[model samples]
Target: MIRRKVVLHFPREKVDKPIVSKLVRDYNLDFNILKASITPKEEGLLVMEITGEDEDYRRGVDYLEACGVEVQPLSQDVARNDERCTHCGACLAVCPTRALYLDGESMEVVFDREECVACELCVKVCPPRAMEIKY
Candidate 1:
C-alpha cells in the first residue's frame, strides 16, 4: 500500500469533530495524530500520517482541501536533514510523529522519514533552521 503523510492545519476544535471523523471513515485510511498545539476549545494544528491507495489518497486530499484545511504531501528530504543540524532535540519535542529522536548516549538527533508526517513543525521549532523540505 502507498503511504502518504498529510498535514492538516486547522483550528484545534476542528480536529476530533465531524470533519476529521468523516475523512477517516470515508477514506478508510490509516491515520495517526502527530501534533496538537491549540488551546483548550481553541484553534490548533493537527499533523496526521495517512496510508492507502493512490486514488484514495488523492481523493482524501481533495476532500480535506475542500474543508478549508491546508493539506500537503510529506516530503522525505524535509524529514531527513544532514546539514545545518545541531541535534539539539528542539525539533524532537515538537515532532507530532515522533519521527525525530535524540540518542540518549550520543546526544544526536535521529530521523525516521517513514514516521514523519511532514507537518513542518520540526522546521518551525529548529533554532538554527537546519530542517528543510527538499521539494
Candidate 2:
C-alpha cells in the first residue's frame, strides 16, 4: 500500500468534472480531502491524501495528468527556525496533523517534518514568527 498527499489544481474548465471520483471508482484509491476551493469557470484547488496500491497510485496520478490536472506534492517547503521559535506551544494548538507537539522531557516543541502537510495553521498561529514557508 502507498499513501501520498498531493495538491491538485483543476483548470477552470475541468472544475465540474468527475475527475477525483475516477480515482476511487477506476483506480480503487481512497482519499481524504484536507481542503478544497473549487468554482465553476474559475480555478480549483484540492488538497487530499491518496491511499492505494503502489501501481494503482501511479496509474491514478497519470490519469489525473492526462485529464489536465496539475498534480504537486503537498509540502510547501515549510521550515521552522529554532532560534526564533519561542516554543510557547502556540503552534501545537492549531496543528491538525500532530506535526507540532511538546516534548515530554525537554518541554520544547518537536516538529515532525514528515508528518506536516503544509496546512499553514501553525504558521498563522505562531507567535515568535518561527515557522516559514519557502517557495
Candidate 3:
C-alpha cells in the first residue's frame, strides 16, 4: 500500500459533492482527514492522508482531477528551529500526535518528524516562534 498526505481544493460548485467518499467506494482507498474547511456552495479545502494500492491511488487522483478538484501535496509542513526554541513546553500541550516531547534528563524539547502530521497546532502555540510552517 502507498500512503500520501495531500490537500484538495474544491471549487465552489463542487463543494457539496461527495467527492472524497467516492474515492473510498470506487477506488478502494482509505483516508484520514486531518483538517477540513468545507462550506456548502463555497470553496473548500481538505487536508488528509490517503492509503491504497499504488495504482488505485493514481487512478483516484486522476478521478479527482477529472471532477475539477485541485490536488497538491500537503503544504503546511512544520519545522522547528533549535536555536530559536526556548524549551518552554508550549508545543507539547498542543501536539495531538506527541511528536513534540521533553527529554526527561536534558529538559529540552525534542521533535519527532515521522510522528508529525503537520497539523499546525505547534506553530500557533510556540511563543518564541520557533515552530514554522513551510508552504
Candidate 4:
C-alpha cells in the first residue's frame, strides 16, 4: 500500500460534505485524520494520512480535486531547523506521536522525522522557534 500525508482545503460550500468518508466507501482507501478544523459555512482544513493501492490513491486524490477540495502535501506544513534548536525538549510534552523526544544519556532533544504526522503542535510550542510551519 502507498501511504501519503496530505492537507485538504474545503471551500465553504463543500465543508458539510462527507468527503473523507467517500474516499473510504467509494475508493476503498484508508485514512487517518491527524488534525481538522471544520465549521459550518466556513472553509475547512483537514490534515490526513491516506493509504491505498497506488492507482486507487491517485484516483481518490483526483476525486477530491474534482470536488473542489485543494490538496497539498503535509510536508509543506511543518519543519524543524536543527541549527536553531537548543534541544531544550519543550516540544516533547506536546508531540502526540512521540516524534520529539529527549535522549536520556545525552539530555538533548531528538527529532524522528518519520514519526512526525505534521500536526503543528511542536511549531506552536517551540520557544526557540526551531519548529516552523510553512502554512
How do the candidates rank by TM-score, highest first? 2, 3, 4, 1
| Model 3 per-residue lDDT tens digits across residues 1-135 | 999989999999988778899899999999999889977767899988999999999999999999999999976778888899999899988999899999999999999986678988888799999998877
Model 3, TM vs. native: 0.84
Model 2: number of backbone collisions: 0
* Best lDDT among the predictions, by candidate number: 3
| Superior by lDDT: candidate 2 or candidate 3 | 3
For model 3 the local lDDT of residue 80 reads: 89
Top-down lDDT ranking:
3, 2, 4, 1
Over 1-135, each residue of candidate 2 has an lDDT whose tens digit, in order, gives 998889999999888788999999999999989889987668999999999999999999999999999999886767999899988999988999898999999999999987787878878789889999976
lDDT per prediction?
A: 0.73, 0.90, 0.91, 0.89
The reply for model 2, stretches above 4 Å from the true place, is: none
User: Which residue segments of model 1 deviate by more than 4 Å?
Assistant: 11-16, 40-42, 74-111, 116-135
For residues 55-94, write the lDDT of model 1, one tens digit per residue: 8878888888787777855444564557878777888778
**TM-score head-to-head 1 vs 4, winner:** 4
lDDT: the better of candidates 1 and 2: 2
What global local distance difference test value does model 3 have? 0.91
lDDT of 2 at 15: 88
RMSD in angstroms, all models? Answer: 5.7, 1.7, 2.1, 2.5
Q: Please report the TM-score between candidate 2 and the true structure.
A: 0.87
Clashing pairs in 4: none
